[model samples]
Each structure stands twice: as structure tokens, then as C-alpha cells.
Target: MGRFGKLETDVHIKASASKFHEILHKRTHRISNVSTDKVHGVDLLEGEWGEVGSIICWRYFHDGKARVTKERIEAVDKQNNSITFTVIEGDLTEKYKSFKFNIQCIPKEKGSVIHWVLEYEKLHDEIPDSHSMLQFCVEMSKDIDAHLMEGSEEPYHNDISGQKCEALSINKSKKRHVWHCLIFLGLNQNTMGRFGKLETDVHIRASASKLHEIYHERTHHISNVSTDKVHGVDLLEGKWGEVGSIICWRYFQDGKARIAKEKIEAVDKENNLITFTVIEGDLMEKYKSFKFKMQFIPKEKGSVIHWVLEYEKLHDDIPDSHTMLQLCVDVAKDIDAHLMEGSEEP
Candidate 1:
């Protein structure tokens, strides 16, 4: 018998189960709009959506390559908010004898839960379990959930993978480098915590250690700091740029001067992971809490730098972080441009 594996995952999101299932049944084609960077497009291949034996084709970028998948609707249970799709062609077929997805939505005390089950049989013993494939499912569920929740909100793109690389995606599912985040209020509104991860490819990049030094220690010395949305940064307490370090950022936001106090919680020199937790300042006044992290993953062409932010919103009207995130992205762009001009690292 061929090796078989199953992956079951449940995620909670603020949405309606019926609406969620309806999207799965009808709007499967729009996933590309929500996750434009990863899922390039999804097209109807044959038959009709929600009907048994219907076919759908997906075009996506994953792991630095473009890939495709064709699936057939094998089952549907309207009352249970459940549907199943069997992989009849494409990448999964190359190594797997057969694969399918069983999806269900269960209402919860608050919001709803998305339950996914993946059943697959490998063609050979050397084939591995569908761990990444499972992750792909989880990510897809989140994208769909986010899409439903975003109602009327502008579409957003979190970069996926490193530059020149995005994994195969479905209806706005997998991203190469970046991931979406839902701004959340206190625990009452966000029993499920939220965070955002952003990444950029640094051309003419510095080594991880070198990039870490500049990002952590010498950021205050940047000349374009003012133009990049940051006026200045000061080392408030502890050693600068080290674990347990404390720093204060003085910046402009919405035409107002703002300050944030953050402490370095963890640093991994070997893997180039850095974690910072926001402890106080104007940000704490507006946000429940915050954390920022940076990671430097090396690549053959250059390097990939990741900036991650975790924060709880004070209120629903506080406005999404789209502009703030754009500022961070702008800062990175300015830094790289300045570094190239100066012939320096950090």
C-alpha cells in the first residue's frame, strides 16, 4: 500500500460560516485579487462551481518557481458547510498517488472556526509527508478569511518569499516573503492574537552580520532618517543593539511626532533572527502592546531582510497600519539606496 498522511487544522476568524463556505463555492476565482503577489490567477476549467465533478485551475508562484494545479469538486454538503476537492493533475500528482481536501466550518462561541483535512497517498516511500502542503492549506484558509473580513477595506499585499521567488499559490494563498495581519483590539475582540511580517530583497546586500549591525546599532546615524519617516532613534537603556537592549524611536506619524520604547527580547546571530518587544511610549498609549523583529536570511544572489510587527489596536477606528507599514517599507528603500550611494554597509 502507498504511504498515506492526513493533516487537520482549525483556525478561528471573525466571519460567518455560511459566507465563508459560499466564497469557497462561488468566488474561488477572486483569490488572486486578495493575494496578488502569490496567486497570479485562478480560472474555471470545466463544468460549474459548487457542482460535483467541476474542474478549476490555479496559477501560482512558490519557492522561486511558478506552478499549477487542477482540481475537481468531489463532494459538497451544504448543511455542514463542507466541500471536498480532489487533485486530478499538476504538482501534487507528480509524487502523490492521489490527494484531496475536506473542509468544514463550525460556529464557535465567538466568530467561527475553519476546519481543514488533507488526505494524501504518496507514490513512493521516499516521498515525505505533506507538511508544507498542510501549511499551504492553513495559509489559504487565512487568506480567504481575511478576504471575507476585509469587506470594503482596500486590498493589501504582503510580500511573499524572497525576491525572485514566490511559491505556487491558489486563490490568494501562499506568499514567498510576506504575510497579512489583522489589526486587533483588546482580548475581548482578539482572542486570537494577530501579527504582520514584512520582507524585502536587498540588492547589493550586506552579509547577515553586517546587515544586523546596521539595522540594530547604527540606524540613528543614517542621514536620510528624517526623510524615511524617522527623525531619530536614541539608545535609552542597556547596550545598544544587543539582547536586553532598550531603544527609543522618535518619529513622525500622520504629521505628528511620536515616540516608542522597545526592548530587544531575543537575537539569533547564527540564523539572523531578532525579536524586539515594544514596552512603552506613545505607541503603548495607542496600542495595547507591540513587538518588532528582523531576520536576515542569506540567498545566492543577495540577501532577504524581514521585518515583523506584532501589536494590538486600541480601537476599531484607529485606522489600519497600511500607512505605517508603508513608512517602514519606505525606510528600508531609502536605507538601501543610501547605503549603495555611500559604498558602506549598515
Candidate 2:
């Protein structure tokens, strides 16, 4: 073998992490029932299912050819929701000297993100990279994600207009989905249209970089990000803090739980800023559109946080964005205090 290759991809899912991890490791053979189009059969050939050193054979079709892949269980880390396997036989052996695959399902507040990795050594330079195999794995991951999302309480991925979106019921039959997660935090206004900014700042004893790290990398640390007022934040389609990615905010507003999906319009790490543009939600009832922008500015000790709402009035008889701004301020302060308190601890 003279060639080596590795590839990694992330698949966003709104399913329970523990549940999906179970399906991936403990009940992998059941995938045939979930998606017959991809997985034909999975047979345990040797030691035991899911245990290290156990050999398993997969009978599947890839790139329009029937293929077999025999893999040995190498490691299973439950705490991290990860599993590893080494290919021992099958069509993969025809082109590779050795192949290792690692799958990790990372849990988020509202869903899970599966990180799939493949490391392989090819037998010759003529053998192409395992692009088709990676695509096969990604499709399989999506199938499992759809199956698990079926069990969530509120399918945040659905079009939560007061009227149930028929498309949802239709997809429910096909065992697939078209929508993803969305979130929103706004107040019902009694007056006409007005623009407002929710500005809140805190002086944490911790450093600026620490404040950013706690928020940027680990947003689940912010308590108010997921709660009664805001159902949850599901990353529908991108990196956590990257621009142009989409996110769904599940919300509990006015005696009802709804979803508002938005796109990440901007991300300025150097300035500690992230902006979300609301594309669809109950807020569409009274407003043409809305944008939520949160920024953290370095202060003397910690950071000065700012939450702004730039929105347009759908009509004239709607409420303003004050209460929503206040809510934003309260949430920001809560996060600041929570972080500050954590910083003072041993």
C-alpha cells in the first residue's frame, strides 16, 4: 500500500443522542429495517456485536455494485458516544491495505451532530479515494437521524404555522423530512412598529477570551438559550459559530410552542459577534422579518454584551420589540452572572 486518505463530515440531527448512539452501536443490524435502500443486511460473523474484537459483515450495495464489508469492532466509548471499526474483508479490501472508521455522535441541547471519519491505506496509486463510501455513510447517518427525530416531543423541524403544514403529514408517510430546527424570542406588542436594541453589559472577573470561549464554543452553557421561553436551539445546517449556517430556535410564546428557523448572517470572532436572521416563525404573524444580533465587546475585565433587534412592521397595529428586547437583556445578564460565578469557583 502506497496511498493513504482520510475524510470527515458532520451531520446535524434533532434526535436524542443516547438513543441514536444505541442505534449506531448496539443495534446497527436493525438499520436494514430503517433504510432498506441503503443497508441490505448486517451479520455478526465472529466474537460479539459491539464488543471489541468482534467481527461483523455488512451486505450492502454501493456505487451500483453489490459489496461486502467485514469489520472488527475496535473500540466503543460510551461516555463520548464514539465507536471505532477496522475493515478486515470485503470489497474495500480490494483497493485498501487497511481501513479504520471512527464515528462520534456529539450531543447538543436540542439534537446531535455525528462526526464520521475514515482512515485508509490504499494498495496502489490507481485506486481512487473512498468518496462513494463516505457518501454512503452520510446517507446512512441521515436515515438514522430521521428515524430518531420521529421520537421527539415537539418536532421543531416542522412548519409550526397555527395550521399544521400538510407537507409535514405527507413526509411523515415517506419517513423523511424537509424542514429543520428554528428558534425565536420576541414579545407581543400592542402598538405599531418601532425599532429597539437590547443592550446589556457585564464586568466579569474572568478574561475576555474566557468569556468568548464559554459562549462561542459551548453555547449550551448559556441557560436561557434553551428553556420555556425558548424551546431549544438546533443547528439545522452548519458549524456552531460559522457564518451562513442555519439554526432553528424552538420557542414557547403566547401559550404555544413554535419554531423559528434562521440563517447565520454574520460571525465576527475577532469582535465576538453573531447575527441570526429570522426566515420563518410565528413572528411572521405581525412582522415582515426580524434579525437578532448578539455581540460581546471586551471591557476592562470581561466583556460588554449587546443584543439588538432590527425588524420591520408587517402592518401598523402590531406591538413593538421592547418586551422582547428586555427578555434578551435578562437572558444576557443571566449568562454573564452564571459565567462570572463559575469563574470565581475553584
What residue pairs are clashing in model 2?
A: 181-248, 182-248, 182-249, 183-248, 183-249, 183-250, 189-319, 231-250
**Alpha-carbon deviation at 2 in model 2, angstroms:** 7.3
- Residue-level lDDT of model 1, residues 1-346, one tens digit each, is 1156555556666777887787777666767777666777767777876788988877777656787778889999999999999987777777776779888887767767777777777766456556456556556766777877878443343333112222233221211222222222223345353333223233334456666667767756653444647877788888876888888887877779888788889988778778878898887666676777778777774465666666666654443354565466557656656665655643
**104 Cα displacement, candidate 1 (Å):** 9.7
Best by lDDT: 1
Compose the digit string of candidate 2's lDDT tens values, residues 1-346.
1166565555556676777777768777777767679877777767766788887777788999877777788999999999998987777777777788898888877566677778877766556556567668867876777776677432123221121111111011111111111111122223212332223233334456655564455554453533546556777787776777777777655567777788878877888777888998877777787888777767664555656677876764464454565456445555555656765411
Among all windows of ten consecutive residues in candidate 2, which has the lowest summed lDDT?
Answer: 164-173
Instruction: Tell how far residue 51 is off in model 1, in angstroms.
Output: 5.1
Best by TM-score: 1
Question: lDDT scores for all predictions?
Answer: 0.65, 0.63
Query: What lDDT is reached at residue 79 by model 1?
Result: 94
Worst 10 residues of 1 by lDDT: 171-180
